[model samples]
Target: MDSLILNILTPVAIFLFIALFTLFAVYAERKIAGFVQDRLGPMETGKYGLLQTFADILKLLQKEFISPSASDKILFALAPILIFVAVFVGYSVIPWGPNLIPSNTHTGLFFIMAVVSIDAIGILMAGWGSNNKYSLLGSIRAIAQMISYELPVGLSLIAAVMITQTLNLNEIAFNQGLLSSKEIYFLGFWKVNEIGGIFGWNIFQAPHLMVSYAIFFIASLAECNRAPFDIPEAESELIGGFHTEYGGIRFAFLFLAEYAMMFLVAMLGVVIFLGAWNSPLPNIGPAKLADWTTGPVWGVFWTLIKSLFIVAVQIWIRWTLPRFRADQLMTLCWKILIPLAFVCMAISGLWRILIMI
Candidate 1:
């Protein structure tokens, strides 16, 4: 009974968290853009525009739900929910802190990758249902981009999985903490199992993973349909892309899903490459900074900090970089990222073999 209640409450809590996070993230991105463009972003809504997102949410809630006259009503209405659910369900396996995962599946990483891919189907549905040429083109671009990038994302994750030898995300996170059961080494030389910090992280344990992390990060940016890789939603060209015909609450869900995807991918990167919730500061001599700062609560703190930092970088890149032409985007994924990802995988295999020898 308790377990059943917990399951019910967990999703409710996560839903609330996502809603609140979207509010903060939207406001934060506006401020960040303001800083980048040398303009005040939202000073009028509520001191520093703190309430701007809230105001926008209320407005969206009040707006009339509008659909194209000839649109497929059923699919058009269902697409946003599908898109949002695809991204939302991926959160189940995320390790928020020590034993804090909502669902600690043995195949956690694999599950997330699989479920998140469903967003492509949702996008395609939205486009096709809308019966808009622009929306269809956008969905086509999104599908191709997502499918192409999935290769590098999967290969890079496989590289990390080879090093960890486990598919459990909780275990992967634990392996980077001080209490890890397995011995950790710094650069495959000095043992750092006792030193638990940045040294115990996968990238440091196997330096080649730095390349893998880079590939993962770039592939994730594309997966999230973020800028440079955001041709699917190019405002100037597609006028809001696959969601062109959506309005009111349906559009809000799509918008929420995009930001949620940003956070989701960022958190995944943190868990896989950035030590999850583990402290970066190592225990040295009597300092014991890592020991002092690691616990269930601290775990949540560190995970959020690292993940948010990545999200900030994503936002920065959005404003700083130009959107990639569709051809350039596909070429980067197929020619560049996929090749590097393969090399990373090969190197991981060799590293594991050498360690055993």
Candidate 2:
């Protein structure tokens, strides 16, 4: 009974958190775009159009239910929901705080990558099921992009997991904090201090860790089908990617899933490299608090803050970089990211062997 209640409560808590953050992300993305382009984003809905996404959802729900005449009625209707659920489940294994994790699987890292990576299959289904030409082309492009990028992303993560020597997300946190607990004195000026566990994040751990961070972030952007990598759904070219024929609440589900996955990747990044939920400074945050406060809540708070920052950065990158051509996208992944990740993995293996020696 107690475990049941905890499980129920945990999901509700996380769902609410993801919902609110996503709403904020939607508004912020628009606002940032407006600011960057020297124009107003949403001035009428609520405070700075804070209610813009809510308004958009309501509007979408009320919009026409029209699908293409040639579209597969059942799949056109189901694809958005399917895609949404795929991204939503990816959130389960992510730890928000110290022990504030929802579902802590032994193979948490593998579980996350697997779930997120396979979402490309859903894209393929959605695009092909739609029976629309642009939808088909976009889905094909997305699958190719996902396939090419997943290699580098997975390999880059191998570097971190090798260093930490664990598959558990919380254990990954502990590993990072352990690294943060003792900073290697690099040239007497660079002090990568240990915070606790997740607080140290991952980027500060080693020279290669930073490279992994860059590699992971870029590959993540592609994996999520975000811009400049959003070529799969280029509005001008692909109409809407695999979702070109979706409408009303169905289309909204696609939008929701995209943002949710973005947040999930951010959270995963936080846990793997950003110290689960540890603060950045040396003993300045709750990680320095007594064991009680330093436990889950502080970790959760820091983790959210770190994740929010990453999401915002993702949004920023979207507005800054232009979309890539499908060919250009595939080339970047195979010709560049994959080889770099290969080298990173080799270096990670060598580093571990030396440490053991």
Candidate 3:
């Protein structure tokens, strides 16, 4: 009975959290855009537009659902829901903190990489079902970009897995914490026990993993279809891309899914490179206060902070950089990031072997 309730309630709670965060992210994006352009955003809503997102939600809710006469009604309606569902499934395996994961599968990382990529299918569905040339072109572009970038993304993750020798995200995070607990030096020529803290993060773990992280971060930007690489939804090009034909609640679902994907990638990056829920501050090793801060509930707190920081970087990039030309986008993936990821993965493997020896 307890397990059953936990199983049901956890997912519900996660969805609620995602919804709330998505609202805040929208507001933040607008406010940041305003800041970048030296304008006030949402000043007319509620308290500098605090209530703006909610108002927008209400307005979207009241808008009538409209589909074009030529559209495939069934597939068009299903696409948004599928997109959102794929993100939710991908979010399930994340280790927000100790014992906090909903599904602690052995193949947690693999599951995430696999399921998240399936969202491209939803985009394809939205495009084809809309029966619009623009939408179809946008969807095709999105799929191509996503599929191209998935190579580096997967390779970077596999590099991390090679070091950890496990597919479980929780185990990866746990390994980071363990790695954090001590300072090893000169191939164990000298060891300082329970001294190192923030230095233990995978981002700082080794040179090759750092290279892997760089590849992963860039690949993730493309995966989330954010700026610079947002060729599919480039307003100048595809208007609204695959969701061009969607509006009202369906558009809202697509919007929600995009932000959710942002959060998902950010959280996954934290788990893989930033030490999951581990505090950046060093504590007297193995102390109760450390556990309190790094443990399950507080783990969620740290994870949120780290994830939001990554989201902020993404937003900053969105505002700062121009969209990549389609050819440049493909060239970047195929010519640069893919080869770099392969080299990093090979080096990461070699580094792991040397460390183990």
Best by TM-score: 1
Give the per-residue lDDT digits (tens) of candidate 3, residues 1-357.
999999999999999999999999999999998998899878889898999999999999889999999999999999999999999899889988876789999999989999998899999999999999899999999999999999999999888777667898887787665344334332223232243346556666666778888889899999999998999998887888898999999999999999999999999999998878877765564664454456667778889999999999999889889899989998999999899888888877787777644
Model 3: residues with Cα > 4 Å off, grouped in runs: 178-193, 284-292
Q: Candidate 1 versus the native: TM-score? A: 0.98
Top lDDT model: 1
Candidate 2 residue 297 C-alpha distance from true site, Å: 1.9
RMSD of each: 0.9, 3.3, 2.3
> In model 2, which regions exceed 4 Å deviation?
178-200, 284-293
Q: Over the stretch 132-193, how does candidate 2's per-residue lDDT look in tens digits? A: 88999999988888888888889999988887777888667754553333343221234434
Whole-model lDDT for model 1 versus the true structure? 0.92
Which candidate, 1 or 3, has the higher TM-score?
A: 1
lDDT of 3: 0.85
- The residue-level lDDT of candidate 3 at 239 comes to 88
Question: Looking at model 3, how many pairs of residues clash?
Answer: 0
- At residue 289, candidate 3 shows an lDDT of 42
